[model samples]
Target: MKRFFMLAFLVGLIVSGFAFKVIMVTDIGGLGDGSFMDGTWAGIVKAAEEYGLEYEVIQSKEQSDYIPNLSKAAEEADVVFAVGFLMSDAFFKVAQQYPATYFVGIDFSFPEEKNLPNVMTFTFKEQEGSFLTGYLAAGMTRTGKVAILGGIPIPPVQRYVIGFEAGVKAYNQIHKTNIKVKSVYANTFTDPKKGKEFGQALISEGYDIIQQACGGTALGLLEAIKEENQKRANIDNLPEFIDDLYKNGGVFMLGGDIEQEWQAPGHILASAIKRVDVASYLGVVKAYTGEWEPGNVELGIKEKGEGISRMPFTKGLVSNKLLAEIVYIQNLVGIGKIKIPSTEEELKAFWLKGIEIPF
Candidate 1:
C-alpha cells in the first residue's frame, strides 16, 4: 500500500473551521487499496468542505517514512492527523517535538498512563464490527470454511481476528454446525502479490470465504477472487444471487476499515464498517473550536463508530433472511448484550459463556 502525493486541497468548512490548516499522514497502506487510508482521507475531504478548511495529504510509502511525514506535517499544520495505529510511537515523538501543534491520531492506542497535552487519539472497537463479518462468513459458507487475513499480527489486527473467530464459533454453537476458520498474516501491508497468492491458495484449499483485514495487501486478494470467479463463471448458468453463488462454489470476502463491498461486488459479501472518517472529521471540529484536549476515545457500535454495512453491491443477491440475522446480531452487540471478544482469554470465556441471540 502506498499513498501518492496530492496538491493541497481547499474546501469551505464551518465558520470556526474556516481558517484552520490540517494535514494527514497516511499509514503504510497510503491511499486507495480500498480500505483504511481511503476512509481517513474521506474525513479530511469532508471536513474541508463542511468547515472551509485547507488540507494536505502526506502519503507514507514505508514504515520509515512515518516520522518524517508526521514531522513535516506538524511544522505547518494547526492540527496534524496521524492516520494509523502503526504510527503511534512515531506520532508521539512528533507531537512532543512540536508541542505547539495539536495532533490527532486515528486508530491510535494509548499505552497505560501515557497522555500528552497536545495529542488526542481515537481508537475503535474494530472487534465488534469484525464479529458481524465473522458471523456473515460462517452463515454464508457452503464449504463450512472461512478465513481471516491480516496485514500484520498487531493487536489491532488481532482484535479483528479474535472477534471474527468468536463470531464464527457463536454461529456454530447456535446452529450446531462445525465451521473451520483459518487465520493468516502477511506481516507486511504493502505486498499485494503475497496477498493474492495467499488468497488463491486458501481458495484452492477449500476455504471458500476470506475476510480481509489487511490494507493494500487486500488488493491482491480481491484480484484473486475476481480471477477465481471469472474462471468459475464460464458455466451454463452463473448464479446471480448469494445462495446460488454459494451453491455453485463461488467465494466471498468480507473486509474492514471501510466499504470494500464494492471492490469485488458479488465476490465481496460485505465489509465491517469502521467510521474512521467520522473520527477524523470530529477531531478537526474539536480542534477548530478549541475544545481539543489530550485524551483517548474508544468508539464502538454503541457510539455509531463501528458496525456492518448495508449490502449495496450484493443487493438483491444476498438473502433477506440472512441479512436480518446479521442485523440482529449487530444490534445485540450495539446494545452490549453481545460482548464480542478482543483477546484470547475473553474469546475463550465468550465461547464458554455463549452468545446471546436477540430475536
Candidate 2:
C-alpha cells in the first residue's frame, strides 16, 4: 500500500526541495492488530505527513518474506523500518547489504560488541510497563488468579511475562495473599485461532484477568474476552458499561503496545503502552535533518516510553485507590528505586528479594 502525505512548509527543514522516501516492512502480523505493529505504522504515517515524505508499507505473509522484503525496501528507501523482533535476523542481513540506506529495527537488540554503521535500533522496556499491569491485575482479580498469553518465548515477550509475575508477587507480599500468574506461549505471533483457544481455556480455568503480548494473535484474545463479557452481561442483565465489572463477574484482558479498547470495548482493561510511534517519528525527523546516526536506544519508564493506557472504555472498573497505587509504583519504577525483572532468572531472584513496601 502507498501513502503520500504533505507537510506544511518548514523553513528549517533542509529538504532541499526533495522528500525522503520511507518503507515499512511488517511482520506476519501485518497491521490492524491494534498492537505494536500498528503503533509502529502510526508513527511512520505521522512522520511522513510531518516531513511530506512518500511512504509505502509491505505486509509480509510469512517468515520467508522477511529477507526479500527488506532487500526490496532498501532498494529505493532513504529510511526503512523492519517491525517486530522476529525480523531482526533478516534485518541484520539486509542492512549489511545496503549501507546507503538507514535501517530501523523495532524491538531489535544487538550485543554490546557489535555495531552496524547504517542501522539504528529501538528496544522497549516492556517489563516495566507489564509490571504496572500485573500490579493492577493482582489488586483487581476476583479469582486470586491472573494469566499471561505470549505469542512467542522471545526475549521481548518474555519480559512481559516475567515482569507481570514480579508485580503479582510484589502485591502478594504486600497484602499477605497469594495471587498466582500463569504464563503460556502459543509459539506464534500471527495465529489468531490459537490465541483464541488459549484465551478461552485460561478463562475456563478460572483466570479472570489476563495480559497478552501476542501481537496480531491477540486479536483473538480480545474476541474471547468480548464473548465472555457479553455472556456475563446477558446472564446478569448488566449495564451498557463494564463499570465495576471485576466486582461483578466478567473476565478482562490487558493489551500490549497500544490502546486496544476499540477491539473489545469494556472487556479490555488497558494496554501496556510502548512508545514505538514516538521512536519511529523521531527517527524520520532526525534522518531528515541530517542528524541520523547508527545507535541503540533503549527506552523505558524514565524515557516516557513505557506505561499503561488511559482505559477510555473501562475506567470505572479500576478503582481510584488502585489507580493511585499504580501511580505510586510507577513513580518508584521511573526513578529507578524499583527494578523490574525481565528474564526468568531475574524473576526468581526478584521473588527472593521480596517487595519492600515502605508504606
**lDDT of all predictions, in order shown?**
0.83, 0.85
TM-score of each: 0.90, 0.91
Cα miss at 301, model 1 (Å)? 0.7
What is the C-alpha lDDT profile of model 2 across 1-359, one tens digit per residue?
12322343453355644557999999898887788888999999998997789899999999999999999999978999999898988999899899889999889876566588888899999999899899999998989999999988988998988888988988887778899899999998888888899999999999999999998888788788878877777544334446446557689899898887777677788888889998898777777778887888899999999998998877777778778888888888898878898878888878525335554
Model 2 bad stretches (over 4 Å): 1-17, 112-114, 235-239, 244-247, 351-359
Predicted candidate 1 versus true structure: per-residue lDDT over 212-275, tens digit per residue: 9898998899889878887876443424544456557688778787888766667788898889
Clashing pairs in 2: none
Clashing pairs in 1: 1-190, 12-52, 13-50, 13-51, 13-52, 14-50, 14-51
Which candidate number maximizes TM-score?
2
TM-score, prediction 2: 0.91
Model 1 CA deviation exceeding 4 Å by range: 1-18, 235-247, 352-359
lDDT winner: 2
